[model samples]
Target: TETLTNRDNHNYDDVMDFYLMDNGPNVTGYVNKGFDVHLDDFYNNLTADKKSSFFLTALHESQHTMGLQHPFESGFDEWVHNSKIDSTGSSIMSYNERDFNGNNDLRIYDLAVLHYRYGVNPNARSGDDTYGFKNFEQNNADGGVYIWDGAGVDTFDASNEKDGNGVYVNLTAGSRIYRGGNTIPNWTNKHLGLQEINGS
Candidate 1:
């Protein structure tokens, strides 16, 4: 009979919350000066094509980190207007893919941008130097390359390049010389500022 009388009901609830604590103020002073480049597992195992692609990707990303922007990023018309330098045949920053589809080295405009950004390396290859296809078939197969020489009387020896298509050598500063072949890209090789060129 006493159990029939009920007391006032009471309820209790429990709640939990989480908050991320700030460690400290953000770091400063290295705004555009430093960057981290990350390559995934694919980089560890590269085929011939992948190697070229990896090289291009590394150069392209490094240029971005160094404050370089693609000409077509904003100025679409300008990129088309300056097709010479705004194309992949000339600039690595260019999105336009040309005959040099699998270019392994930096193009002319890429070299220009780097020089403009960091200034020329005055101490590069100051001694007498000779550049040529050590192994013609192998070099041609590997694709284009650029030779940067700094204040030296250099020579371009094409003795080993027995390609009957003929070799065109330009011994001027920042000019490219290439062999005539339907197989070779338009701008396949260049030796910047060479004093001598022989062995045709």
Candidate 2:
């Protein structure tokens, strides 16, 4: 992937270019074979909460290069619904929002595809990490998140969340959890990582 600063004299032959421009309506960014990624200038116009930032847009577009498609585009709505997984809320590929506003990480479905394609990264988030409202907000993981920790003791602390009464706290991957008053996808390997789930 190439980040071109000089679009005036840039070459689009063998590299994936990421740049900003006024592409069209409702189009934030797009990718060509995972090599070329273009973000619309509208990204600069929207509020921070509404726009997932150019970094996330680039991440979404980059997934296209890996041959991933939107859940609706791939006709996976039935599965998505049956499984109780909101693609737009959990996957970056979707051009919609369901939960809080936007997500920062790869979410559940995106991780599934990535793990299938390149296997799981055993070193992701390898630290004494915590998952909760403040943690998610600090990281801009509003949409949802999938915790793939490699090592160290981890925790899922929702005790500080006042609206976490009916929140489901599961240790299995792909289960939905409540965060910021909204139920969203959040999975963690409890057996391998998280040792406790402190709920409200």
Per-prediction TM-score to the true structure, in the order listed:
0.44, 0.50
Alpha-carbon RMSD of each model: 23.6, 11.4
What C-alpha lDDT do the candidate models reach, one value each? 0.51, 0.57
State which candidate has the highest lDDT.
Answer: 2
lDDT of prediction 2: 0.57
What does candidate 1's lDDT look like per residue over 73-139, in tens digits? 5433433565655667666677777656766666655665455344456697788888885322212
Q: Report the backbone clash tally of model 1.
A: 0
lDDT of 1 at 132: 80
* lDDT at 87, model 2: 44
Runs of candidate 2 with Cα error greater than 4 angstroms are: 1-15, 44-54, 75-77, 80-83, 125-200
Lowest summed lDDT across 10 adjacent residues in model 1 is found at 191-200
